[model samples]
Target: MQQDERQRKMKIMEVRMREIELSLSNVKLLLREKVAQLKEQLHKNGKADVLIGNLYDENDVLLEVLEKTKQRHIILEKKNFLLEEKISSLNKIMCDLTPPPSLPYHY
Candidate 1:
């Protein structure tokens, strides 16, 4: 009985392995088909091939520019905030230094 049970378990494992291998093969085939389709499309439109090839580089450059712009924006915002605070402080000092208006005496 124990031997029979072991054989049954072995068969189940074998079947599972085969299913996994078949799934993998199917995925590989689909990927190959997709690549072939893309190649065909590229062949039909030769100009698109260059664009597709350079797209990654172009995207990288654009991303770098965006990052630099963001950094500059942050710096400008901080400077603006500091300037506002300084202006507020100067206004307070001016108000403090001013003398009060004298009242007119009765004629």
Candidate 2:
């Protein structure tokens, strides 16, 4: 009878061991799936980061171009003012060099 009881206990232990092994296998599979998902997410995030960086670089270049354009506009405005002054001076000189016509009247 003791031998029979021992045999029954051993059987129960074997069954429990099998259940634990199945549970461990399931946990391992879930872990592997989660790791794979995380890796994929990391890859996508890396690509997004690179894209954002490139956009920032492009924005910086555009800002530089805009600054240069503004400076050029200012320079042109100054040049235009100088040219206008020179043209006015030349017109005055030309008017002064011309002779006035004389009118004759009999009283």
Predicted candidate 1 versus true structure: per-residue lDDT over 1-107, tens digit per residue: 99999999999999999999999999999999999999998787887777877998899999999999999999999999999999999999998998877788899
**What does the lDDT read for residue 60 in candidate 2?**
100
Largest TM-score belongs to which candidate? 2
Q: Which stretches of candidate 1 lie over 4 Å from their true place?
A: 1-42, 45-47
Query: What TM-score does candidate 1 reach?
Result: 0.53
Evaluate candidate 2 by giving its C-alpha RMSD to the native, one decimal: 4.2
C-alpha lDDT values of all predictions: 0.95, 0.98
Q: Per-residue lDDT for 7-46 in model 2, tens only?
A: 9999999999999999999999999999999999999999
RMSD of each: 14.8, 4.2
How far is 18's C-alpha from truth in model 1 (Å)?
Answer: 45
Q: What's the TM-score of each model vs. the native?
A: 0.53, 0.63
Instruction: Name the 10 consecutive residues with the lowest summed lDDT in model 2.
Output: 98-107
Clashes of each: 0, 0
